[model samples]
Target: MAFYLVELTKSVTVHPRYFHAKLGDHVIGRLLALTEGTTSGRYGYLIAVVQVERPLPPGRILPGTGHAVFPLRYKALVYRPFLGEVLDGVIASLTRHGVFVAVGPLSVFVSARNVPSDMEFDETEQCFTSVVQGSEDRLEVGTLVRLRIVGMRRDATEIAAVGTLRADYLGVLG
Candidate 1:
């Protein structure tokens, strides 16, 4: 799910104190500070700011402010999960409706309907349990599980995922 070497353009404001000979370094530092660990609306999570391309001339200083704004072009590493991709994560919580698994920064929900048909919710234990032949399987908080991304929904602030563990090899990982 990690995307490497993606080109991007960003605008950075340089304070007057940083206008000296090390201006390029200052600008690059500012760009990394602003973008590293930030999420892109189009891309998923930005892991790091790898490199800065050719630096364009700084734009005109703002009136009365004396700060220079520069358009910076750069490349970054990002992580974006795609639909139908299978991932392993720890179970964060269990609800009456489903299980919530935390996969890095992403939270995925595997609805009750998406769990294996044999599994049933155990209200007293707050977990899902199933018995196949003579063996017992259980899924609870902190359990490691493998799931397939079935759907995703994103808004301005967050991304949510719908997952399924009903398929073969897609369940509690033991």
Candidate 2:
């Protein structure tokens, strides 16, 4: 996965109730609501609003509705991942079954079936653990890990991926 900064122009619509002194803020807020955290094939997942052009553009009110539409140009940070890509992620959550890793804007699932047999779920400790070379290695919440993208699905506002920690150079990180 990778993040990219790009300039984009999006049309943001604001309700009539928000048409006040700070209409610019309202418009930009609406734009952020629509774009941020949303995923598209073209730009992937729009992470954050980087900048908004100064002196907000004029809005055109619709015919039947009183909503104002503004063509806002702005810069944003986006994340798009590819198959077979190796990426570093933090273990957001873990279970006896598997773990959920957050890689940038994408959440990847590392299934237990794909995990190495050397590790096992420690019910008492509530984590995946292993011992090698007289040292203990644990996979728990907040653990840093590296994985390869095995499969992916892009939805309207989300990018779901299935990752594996069994490959070479993959797995727990110190």
Candidate 3:
């Protein structure tokens, strides 16, 4: 549906007496878990899943006696709404109007009529000019593009929205 709060900073002991938690952190009580892909960034880095809500106190850290309070479970992995969803993005930047696909960690918007119809828009070197010009290749600016999620809009603050790869296998992925 719609949920996002992600925040663990970094510190997860993992199964040391039911996953004893510590290290400048917290994990509020009761059920908390989320995990479902993407978090490495070749393009978008989107991976999320959290679970922390108890279990502490075991051997270790007793010299001065301090460390272990647990109560920090924020949880965030939001994106679950693209109106159609067919993500596979790259092309981090390109502008004269559009081309910004990063699909999953959020950055989707392939305007300029969703590029790829032989791509042409050189109002005299404004941008998007490559119907095979100069022969070095085309789709410049970190190209790796591919998109498909015709439309998606959200208001009431702004989670960000706007996507269109034109259609079929989307475009520019070579």
- lDDT tens digits, residues 1-174, model 2? 588998999998888999889888888888888888788876788889999998888999998999988998899998889999999999999888899999877889999987767888989999988756565778999999999999988766567899999988899888
Return the lDDT, model 1, position 53. Answer: 83
Query: What does candidate 3 score in Cα RMSD to the true structure?
Result: 11.9
Q: How close is candidate 2 to the true structure, as a TM-score?
A: 0.83
lDDT of 3 by residue, 7-38 (tens): 54333333224433342232332223223444
How well does candidate 1 score on lDDT at residue 40? 56
Task: Tell me model 1's lDDT, rounded to 2 decimals.
Answer: 0.86
Worst ten-residue run, lDDT, model 3?
A: 26-35
Q: Of the candidates numbered 1 and 3, which has the greater lDDT value?
A: 1
Error of 1 at 159 (Å): 2.4
Model number with the top lDDT = 2
- Cα RMSDs, all models: 2.2, 2.4, 11.9
lDDT of 1 by residue, 1-174 (tens): 556668888999998998888998888898989988876557887788887887556566888999999988888987787889999999999987999999887889999999899999989999999957775788899999999999987765567889999999999896
What is the lDDT of every predicted structure here? Answer: 0.86, 0.87, 0.52
TM-score top scorer:
1
